[model samples]
Target: MSQLISIPESYESLNLTHINIAHHPPQSPTATPIVILRLNRPDKNNAFTPQMGESLEQAYRLFHLDARVKVIVLTGAGRMFCAGSDLDIGFDDRVERAGDFRDTGGRVALAMHRCSKPTIAALQGSAVGVGMTMTLPAAIRICHEKSKYGFVFTRRGLTIESCASFFLPRLIGMSKAMALITTGGVYPGLSKYFGELFTEVLAEGTAVLPRALEIAREMAENVSPLASYMSRALMWQGPTSPEGAHLLESKVFHHMAGQSDYKEGVNSFLEKRKANFLCDPYEMSPGDYPWWSEVDIRVGPKASKSKL
Candidate 1:
């Protein structure tokens, strides 16, 4: 007999918009237990603002902390899963305050990468720039045949962020990463050639989101929660040496302990209230200084200056 675990009633009443982050959920449960997180801003082609980024980070944190959630299905709303950063919105003033925008994306990516639960991204349309990077930390990806993936950093006169510099090459090989990063070209048939990058490639117009939900439900229903959790932890920890993993764990532990969100998370669960996290620990601190010094191109020897 399948062991039945009842989802908390509070889960139903809690703001799905906040938790879902995209205001969409599966129509019904599936074979695997699943949590669906949708990116709601379809009007902007699901462009990620700083708030959206923080919301995503928080949503993942919530899923990780919840004993009930076994797997996560990440997708976006409207025609595109995500169109990348919102250039139309202008630079966020907080970007200056945060010092390095890369850190914001890096922290979120680290959280996703280190999560003890598996994550799957369902891609239907365009996933560009950070949208592309966001999918990197996912354990699996399912994309519709026609969906397009691109790395648009160079086009924007910027370099890759979100630890893509480290993670992308590891996944797709250095040459491929360089080609994509340098040229800013969209890669079709990515899911086919790079199955590791995408676990499955669906038929064109196959409804990617529905498939993701189905998978999530199946995982939830069939898998043993404890075993799945342990397996996830093992997989996350297996890559590093015990000493290195312990150090990393300690850093996250200490950081979380110092944050208000840590307290809010516990108190909210105990008091049965929605957690309103006061601080975003994922934001980059201003103290990080760049290691590379700027080059003085003009200091190079001028063509005729040495003639005398």
Candidate 2:
């Protein structure tokens, strides 16, 4: 049994101070701690507010800086994962403040994408609009066999938000993605056809949270944090061509193949014991961590067409 970690009573953004932060024991003695980030709005079906968006970004930062948090399992407190944005509170600060362009949902999605730690969304109940789009960037999304979900943008006369265009198609394929966005209907899950969208499904909503903890414990116990973070970054941020991917992989290999963690892993394998990987992920990462610096695009001189 691992001792529970206590968070300070000071995270004030996005109502994060009220979030249920709990630690679950590792499946094995070697596993690190698993943190649960539960949405605390059972009354509103855990709807997203601008405050919630602020909290999400801050929460991720907290997770990244904390060495004890190996993995994050995101779930809701009520029967539903999230009921999308809170419609009852009818104000337009999120849009008006952003010059009438930025969607708060997209901000939350960007926050999730920016997080270095592995994220798993445990969808116990219905999630629509921002609720559904927000989970698209998670490393893994788990739900019950018959869990409810929705795209709900077109139906609400609002276009898709939360940058789902970049993530949804990549996840469920373009054809299904288009249909879901356009149709905008709530649907039940656990279909054998859409296996990629779901990492694993439980028998019921009640089991989703427990199953997420189990999966998180598996990752915390057996996986090296540095390797996992780097791998995830490469998968999302690496170049388009196979050669580009190879180059990035080679760079990461060069950076990680000779580190202390690598040596410990080798020695542990030879000794037939659980490896104690002590290397911090941030330290193990190459310069600037993600290492994908943007370069200015150069245009070629235009060739004037001569009459032929």
Candidate 3:
């Protein structure tokens, strides 16, 4: 419906030339909706570039705004997921002051994190440096057992980027995270050192994307968009203290009880039918929705008006 891998007319303003956007089901009027974003430069081994990062940020922002989108699938074209940054055009050449400039990978990761839709990364081949770190924000990662992954920052004389400092340890535990960082070595997707980084590691490289798509389809068909988003958000941004968490949970319960989906959810369960959850969670956000303040984090890159 949207010209296969080409950007949809609705998304033209975003100038997403670096990535391909395709809608699952290929029809506009469908209950089950999923969007796929592919890193489009297979010729270059799907290397990460500033343009790619900007396009990804734009896509994630679009996903956040579109209520019809249920799940997002991120993967690369051809064989490799990503080979880290395009080293030919190094990141150190930026003209902005060190304090003012934000790394592209970090910005892209934040955008992915802020998106309300569930996201899955399909790593069909090896991923290194920025590629691996960027996928850390995804809710799930499906990888090929033979695919290699690395946190190769130390080898490049750099520290971590893409908010990996926050997400990597939380995902794989401190010991594994520290070991990976310290070694800066590439390991198989099924490595015990990664803990739970990859939700499913299939034996075949071709199976990774299919498995990711299956999971995305299942999520899109069954999960309540509002409830799913809230659950993830709360888990990531909840209060530290048990008393504070309890208070926040009570407030959320009170707020959700007033929404239409709450009644629909209850009625559907009582009647033994699929619940039609149509409420837009952002629109129905509670008064203290963002209980915590976001300081200087940039949510999205500026969209370009020019056509790609």
TM-score of 3: 0.89
lDDT of 2 by residue, 60-163 (tens): 76677566667889899888888888888642454323344456677778777776678899998878888889899899999877777888989988788888
The regions of model 1 sitting more than 4 angstroms off are: 1-32, 90-102, 190-195, 225-308
lDDT tens readout by residue for model 3, 1-308? 54333323444234475688776766544323688789989998999999899889878877786777889999999999999999987764365446656889998999999888878999999999999999998999999999899999999999999999999998989999999999999999889889999999999999888889899988876677788888887888999999998988889888888888899888989999887888776576778777889777543455688999
Clashes of each: 12, 1, 0
Query: CA lDDT of each candidate?
Result: 0.64, 0.76, 0.85
Query: Which model scores highest in lDDT?
Result: 3
Q: What ranking of all candidate models by TM-score puts the best one first? A: 3, 2, 1
> In model 2, what is the error at residue 284, expressed in angstroms?
2.4
Which candidate gets the maximum TM-score versus the true structure? 3
User: What are the runs in model 3 whose C-alpha is more than 4 Å off?
Assistant: 1-15, 27-32, 298-308
Which candidate, 2 or 3, would have the higher TM-score against the true structure?
A: 3
For residues 186-270, write the lDDT of model 1, one tens digit per residue: 7664543343567777776347877887787666544444334434444444335778666544554464566565676688789
lDDT at 145, model 1: 74
| Position 94, candidate 3: lDDT | 64
Error of 2 at 167 (Å): 0.7
